[model samples]
Target: MADEPVLPTLPKTPFNGLGSKRAWAQANAPPPPSVSTSSDPAVFSSDDDPALEAYESARRHKRRYVGTWYDQHLALSSDSVMGDDGSSTIVGSSPVVYRPQRRAKGAVRQQKRQFRKLDSGVYMGGQDSTDTEGDVPSPYTPKYFVSPAQLRVSPRSLPQVSEAESAARDKIKNCVEYGNQEVDLSGLGLNSISAETIAPIADIAPIPLVVKGVSFEQADPDIKVYLYNNHLKDFPLSLVNIEPLTFLTLRNNDLTEIPTCIGKLKNLKTLNLAQNKLKYLPAEIRRLMGDGGKLVMLHTASNPWWTAEKLSFQAVIEQSDPNPLIRTPVEFLDSNGQIYSRFRLPLSDADLAESTSSLELEVEHPSELEMPKEVSYAEGDHVRLLNPTGARSLFEYALKALTKLPEPELEEVDYWLGVDEGYPKGLRETLNLAADAHRSGGLTCSVCGRGMVVPLTRWVEFHKTAGTIRVDRESLVPFLKVGCSWKCVPARQVVPECEEKLPESDD
Candidate 1:
C-alpha cells in the first residue's frame, strides 16, 4: 500500500495491419557478428575434420527429406525430372530428385503399414514404408506328431475256449494230479460240465495206472462233490456214475429241473437243493426220503413253491352263514383245496345289500358258466402217462379188479381169469404173476385211501413242512391244495408213518 507502483506501458505502432508486428520484429532485430579467420575455439573449427563433414552431410539430408508440401509437389510433378535442355535428368542417390507416382482421378491413396512378428506370436511395429515383395518368408511349415499303427487280430484265429472252461479244466487237472477226494467246484459260474471234464472223477475207485512212467494211485472210494452257487440248469447225469459218492451239494444254482436218474445215487447221504429256480420236483424224490431212504440231510429251502388260486370276496361272502350269532363265515374250500376266506370278515346285512345292488345280476355270460371240459395238461404239469384217456386192456382191467379182492383170495388166484386167452402159456403165466404182484403191492388212492392197481386220479401239491433253519419276515410257506372235483374235500392232515419222521442220521 505504499504509493501505487508505476507500470511500464508497451510501445505502440502507427501501422496496425496483420503483418505489421512481424515486420517491426525483423527491423528491430540485433545485427549479425562479423566473420573472422582466427583460430578461436568458440568461433571457428577445422574444415578438413571427418566428423565435421559427416555432421554437415547428415544435416543436409534431414533438411532435404523434411521439405514443405509445396517443395514435394514440385518435385513429384512428373514421372521424370526435365532439365533446361529439355532432356530427362537421371535420378541419383538423393531422394528429392525422384518423381512420385500419380494417382488416378477420384482415387484414394492408402498408406502401407509394415509389421514385424515376434517369437511370442505378436505384431510389434506400426504402419511403415517397408516393401513386402518377392521374399515370401518360406511359407511357415506347421509341425505335428503321428503315432505308429497297431497290430489287429481276428477272434477266429484264436482257440475257442471260454474263461469258465479254462478254469474247469484247471480244476479237473489238479484233482487228477493230487488225487483229491472232495472236488469243490463252487462259484465257478459254470453253465455246463462236459462229460470229459467229469468222467475221470466219476469212478468209484480208480485203479492204479502208469501214465508217462508216473504211477497214479487210486482215488478215495467215498469221494464228495460240491457244485454250489453255479449256473446249472439241469442235473449233471455224469455225476450218476460216481457210485460211491456219499455227499453232494448243489445249493444256490439256477437248476430248473433235476433228472429222475438222480434217484440212482443210492449212497448219497447229504443233498442241498436250496435257493434254486425249481418250480416242482419229480415224484421220485420220495425215494430219497423216509426211513428206508439213503439221504439223511436234505435241504430244500428258499424255493418258489407255487401259490393257490385266489377266491373272490363275493364268493366268500356268499358262502358265509346268514346267522348273526355265528359272527364269522364257515370254512370254505376253493379249487386249490385251500381256505383263504378265513381272513375276511362276514359282511353285515346292510353291507351285503349294498354290495349286491352294485352287481349286474340280470345278465349272465354263458361262456363263464360253461367251464372248459376237454382237460389239457397245464403249464408245469409233469405228465407220467402219455395217454391220459387210453382205455385199459382186459388184462389191466383184470389186474385192477384183483386189487379189491382179499389177500388170501388174491393169492389163491395166481392167473388172470379170462384176460389171458391168446397169449402163450409162459407169457400167460408171466401176466398172471404180474397180476398177482400188482394185487399184492398196489398203490393206494390219495383221496379215499383205497387200494388201486391203477390210480384214477393223480395230482402233485407242495405241502408246508417244518425246517431246521430259521428265516426272517412273515414268510408264507403255504402248502396250498386245489381240488377240481365238485365234492370239495379239503386235504387231510394225515402224514404216513414212513414220511412222518426224518431218517436217523448216521452221524
Candidate 2:
C-alpha cells in the first residue's frame, strides 16, 4: 500500500474509431478519384480536394499511409507506439520498393558431323584410306591361266644306243664262267642279239651250252647246242661236228627230215624226235646196227611217219632181225607177215623171189610137200606139177574114182560089185593079182582082220587095210603091170602117218 500507482489516461483521436492498424490506414488514406466523362453523371473529383488527390497518387504507387494527420493522431493516443528513427525499417513500412529473382542459365549445344569417299566410287572412313591404285584385292589370281603359245614349244630328246652296244652290255652282265675253263650261255639275256655276235662267243670255247626262247638263226654253230622252246625249221649237216654227243632231243620242232650223218654218232644211246613232221625214214638209219648191235632205244612217236598208210615198218623189221633193245607200242601190229620182233629191215628182191618159188612147189604136190595152209602162197589153187610118176598119178586117180562112185550101204556089196564088173580087163586082172598078194602078205582088215579084198565090199573097208598092203617089187607089179582096182585110203586112217611124212591135205 504505500504510494499506490496511478494509471495514465488515454487520449481520443480521429483514428480512435478504427479497430486495427490496417483499418486505421484505410480510414485516414484518401479515397480513390472517380472517372468522369461528358456522358457520365457528375461525381466527386480530386481537383475539388487536394489532400485526396495526393493520397490517391501515393496509393497508385503502392505507398503506405504515413501523412502528418496520421502521426498527430497516433501521438494523442498513448496505446499507439513509435520506434527510434535511426534503426532498420520493417519490410511493410514502405510499399513502393520491389525485389526480383534471377532466371537459371541454359545448357550448352553440340555441332553436326561430315564424311569423305574414294575415287573408285567406294565410300571409306578416314582411318581406312591408302595411297596405291592397285591396293584393292581380288578374289582370284589372273596369272595362273595357260596361253596357246606356251603349249607349242618343242621338247629335247636323248640319243638312242646301237645294237652292238646293247649286245656288249648284256654279255658283260649275264655271262658266267664255269670251272674257269668254259663260259655257260644258259639264261644269258641275248634277246635281240645277232648271229654274228653269238658266233664269236661260241668259237672262243667249245663247251656244252643251253639256248632257250631264241631262234636258231640267232645261234652260233660252234657251240654245243641244246635247244628248247625254239623255232627251228631245218638243221644243217654241219651240226654233226659236235662229236662224242650221247643224247639228242629235237622234240616239238619243225624238222621234216633227219640228216644221214646221224648214224655216224656211235656214242648216241637214246634219240627222241617226238612231235616232228617226218613222213618216212631214211636208209642211213640201218647202219646204226653197230658191232654186237649197240643201238639201245629210239622214241619216234607223234611223228607223221608212224601213222602214214601203206608204207609199213613191219617189212623192214622182219629183214633186219633186230636184237631185243628196241620197243614198239602195243598198238602196232605186223599184219603183212614181215616184221618179227624189233628191227625194221626191208626184204631184198632175191629173198622174195626164192620164197615165191618154194610156195609154188608146195601147192603143186600138196600131199607130197608139207606146207601151212594158213600161209598164203604166190600160186593159188591152180598149180602145175613136173614129172608126175605112176605112184603119184595112181594116188590122185584113186581119190577121183572113189569120189565118183555111188554111196554104198553098210549091209550089202551091191554098188561096189557093180563098179568092179564095169572095170577094164587090165584093172580086173590087176585087182585079182593085188587081192592074191594082199592075202599072201597077211594083209587083213584093220577092224575085222578077215582076208581083205581089192575093191572091197565098201571103199571104207578097203582104205582101212591099205597101210598093211606093201609097195615092194611084187606090189608095184600088181599096181603098174595092170591097172589096180583098190580104192584110195580113207583120210582118218592115213592122216596121222601121212602128216608125219608129207604136208597136210585139207581133204
Candidate 3:
C-alpha cells in the first residue's frame, strides 16, 4: 500500500467559537443601502416592482411600534380613512397595542404611579390623586335588605324572676332599717342574691343608736348580716361594698367557692362558713389572719376538701415499672416527713379550650387571653413554668408603683387608707378604683411571703391548714400558691446525702 498523502490543514479563525455560522457571516457583512429621501411620489409608487409590492404588503400586515403618546395618537387617527363611497377603510399601518406582563401572586396596583409623558411636553397617563368615583353608585344593586335599626344593639334585660324570687327580693329590700345594728335574712330559701336585692341598704342613713335593756346609747353601730340556712351557691360579692359589716354568717348553704373579694371586709370580725361545699380557700383569705386582721373567728368545717389522695389522681407521672406505687401529692418525702406541694392543677384540656374560646369571644387584648395554663417539671423533677410568662401588665405596673411609695406620701395625697375610709373625690378615686380592682394590692407569694402585683409562678397546693384557722384533723383544703420567681419556689426532689454533706471519714 502506498503511504498516506499529507492533507492540507486550514488555519483556525479567532471567531470560530461564536457558535452559529450565520452570526459570524453577519458580523463580517457590509452595511445595507440607505433609502432615497426623494420628494417625487411617482418614484416610490411603481406598481410594477414586486419587491416594493411585497415590502408594502408586509408593512401593512405588521403593526408599527408607537414610541410616544403623541405618535400613538397620530398613528391611531391616521391608520383609518373615509373612502369616496362613504365607507371606512384602513389607510396606513396600525399602532402597537400595549399588553402588560402577568403580575406575581400577591402583587397589588401601585397607589401612586408615575405618569407617562407625551411628546407635547404633557403627562398623559396615571390615576388621579383623589378618588373621584367614590360617590358613584354601582349599576347593579343588591336585593337583600338590612335595616339600620336592626344593627343597633339594645340594652340587655334582666332575667325573669319567679314568685318566690319576687317575695325574697321584697323581703331583703325591707329587712334592714335605719340605725339597726342587725339584719336578719336567714331561712328565705333564696338561691342567690343580686345587686338589686341588696340596693336598699345603701339608702339607709346613719342614725343615733339606741339599744334596749342597755344603759349606753351609742352614736353608731356596725351592721351584722345573717343569711344562714339559705340555698345560696355563690357568696354575694356585692357585700364587699358594705364597709360597716362586722359579722357575717353563711352557714348551711351550698357555697362551693368564696371570692377573693372576701379580703375587702376590713371591718369583719366573726365569719361562719360551716356546712358548705368548699374544697379550696382563696390565698387572699390570708389577709384576714394575724393581729392586724379584724377577723377574730373563722369557721370552715364540714366541707368536702381536696385531699392528697384526691389530687394525686389528677397528676401526670412517668415510671419504668408497669405497676409502680403512686404516691400522694406525687412529691418527694423528706427526712422530716413533710411533702412539697407539686400537684398538677385540676384543669382538663377540654376545660382549658372552652375557657380560651370564651375569653377570645370576650377579651380584645392578646395579653388578656394568656390565661394560666399547665405546669411541667425539669430534669431533676423541679417544677417549671410551661405557660404564663413572667410578664407584668400595665395595671400591675401602676399598682406596683403606688405600693412602693412611702406611707407619708400616700397619706399626703389623701389616698384611701382602708376599705372603710371613703375614697377621696377626683384624682384619688381613680387610684382607689385601680387599687380595689386588685384586692389588697394584688397577690402574695407563698415562698417569700412578699406582696406581688403580678405573680411569676402560680401553682395549687393541698394544704392541711389555712393560716391559724382550725379545721378537722382529716381535712385537706386546697390553697392557691404563687411566687415572685421560680427561684423562690422550692424544688420537689430530696437532696442526696452526698450533695448535702462531704464524705465524713474520707475527708
Candidate 4:
C-alpha cells in the first residue's frame, strides 16, 4: 500500500525532505497578471443597511497606502483621555485630540503626492527644497498694520509761561492777573492816560537788553518775538536801529500809528498787524511789505487803517493759501476776522455731517441765523482750512458723493510733512479718509483692467511690504497684483529665462 502510489520522482530540491512539492512549484512560478482587491472587502451600499452604513460612516476614513505606515511609524501610546461623563476632556497642558477624517464620497486622490523628484535626488515633498530664495509674501493679502500717515504730530510748545513773562507782567502797577484772565479795570481805579507796556529796565539800555523775551545782544538779529495780546501803545524807537528785522508783531494791541522808522526794517519778513487801533500806515511801511512773494505772509486784519493798508495786504494774504484747505492766520484773517465765524469749522466728522445737514436750513432762513457781531473772540488762527471747489473734507466728500460731485484735488504727497509738523489731528484723519475714498480704485486688477478696491485698513501695510513698488499707498497699489476680489487677481506668472541661443564653439 505504501509503494502503490509512488509516482514520478520529482526534482531534488532543498525542500525534498518536506512532504509536498506543490508548494515549491507554486513559489517558483511567476505571479498571476492581476488579483481581486474586492475579494472580501466590506462593500456596504448606503441603501442596503443604513445602520451598518452609519456605523462605518462614523469611523475615521483611513487614507490608502499611508494609514498603516503612519500607524506603525508613530509609536505613541493609546492614551486618549475622556471626561467622567464620557465627553472629551477640554482641560490640560497636553490635551490630545483625535479628529476624524471627513471626506466626500467618490473622490479621486493623487497617489504618492508626498514624494517628489529633483535634479539632485528623490525626497519627501515636505522636505523638498531648491537652491533659489524662499517664496515672497503677496502684497494684496490683508496684514495687520497701519501707517503713521493718518496720525498728526503736535507742535512743540513751552510747558508754561516763562518766569521772565511772569516778572514782566508783575512790573505793571495796577492790574491783577486772574486764572480765567478776567480783569476788573474799574477796581484798579487808574485814569485813561495810556503808557507803553514795554519800558527800559534801567535809565539807559544795555547792548543786548532782553524785553518780552527778545534779546537785542545777538547779532544778525533774530526777531523770534511773539508780542501779540499785549497792551502796548507806542512803537519802540530802538527797533529802528536794527539793520533787518525778520519778524514783528503789532497785533491785538492798542497802537495809533505805524512809525516812519518801520522802513528801516529792510528785511521785515512777516508782520502781523491785526486787531490794532492804527488809523494810518506810513508809505515807507508799504514799501517794506515784500513783493507779495518775498514777504511770505503779512497779516493786517481788524485794523482801522485806511483802505490803502488793507488793500496792499489783501493780495499777499490770498496768496498765502498755497493749498486752499490748509490755512494760515494771513489766509483766514478777513477785514474783521469774520471769515472763521462765517465758514464754520466742525469739531469732528460727525459735527461736519451735522453742519452740512444744517446748510439748507441756513440758506432758507439766513436772516434768522445769529451772526457774529464782533471779532473779539477770534484766535490768531481763524480758519482751519479752505475747501476745494467740490469737497472740503472726508465728511463733506461722503455727503457730496451722494450729490454726484466730481472728485476734487487731493493733498500733495508732501502734505504729510505738514501732518508731521503738527497739522490738526481731525483734519489729518479727514484728509486720509478722503484720500482713501478718492484714490481707492486708481489701480486696476492684475487680470482685468477694472480698478482694484484697496483695503484701507491694510493699504499701507501692503504698500510697505511690497518689494517691487514699496512706496506711498497711492504709488504702490498700481504696481501690485491687486484685484477687486481673489478671483480677479491673476495667478503669479513665472517666466523663466530661455538660454536657448548658444554661441558657436570657437576651439
TM-score winner between candidates 3 and 4 = 3
Q: Per-residue alpha-carbon lDDT of model 4 for 163-247, expressed as tens digits? A: 4444444543222221211111212212121223222211121235458867456434343334566655665455544443466
- Candidate 1 lDDT over residue span 105-193, tens digit each: 10111111111110121211111101111111212311110001101112222224567756877886777667666788888998877
**Model 3 segments more than 4 A misplaced:** 1-156, 159-165, 202-218, 313-342, 347-456, 459-476, 487-507
The window of 10 residues in a row where model 2 has the poorest summed lDDT is: 105-114
Model 1 clashing residue pairs (backbone): 336-481, 336-482, 337-482
TM-score of each: 0.33, 0.23, 0.42, 0.20
Residue 297: error of model 3 in Å? 2.4
Clashes of 1: 3
Residue 241 accuracy (lDDT) in model 2: 44
Q: For candidate 2, write residues 1-507 as lDDT tens digits.
A: 778885453332332232222333432345432211122322221122234435434543332333233222211111111111111133115311211111000000000000011022121111111111121122231232111112211111112334543544345234323211122332332223333333433233323445697544532222223332334455334334434444555556666666444655565555556666654443233334334223445445566542201112111111122221111111111111222222221123353233321111121221311123222324334323212122334533453343334332211123234456675434433333343333223223322323322322111000001232221211111000111211222222221222232233443
Report the number of the highest-TM-score candidate.
3
Which model is ahead, 1 or 4, in terms of lDDT?
1
Q: List the residue pairs that clash in candidate 2.
A: 316-344, 316-345, 316-346, 317-343, 317-344, 317-345, 370-503
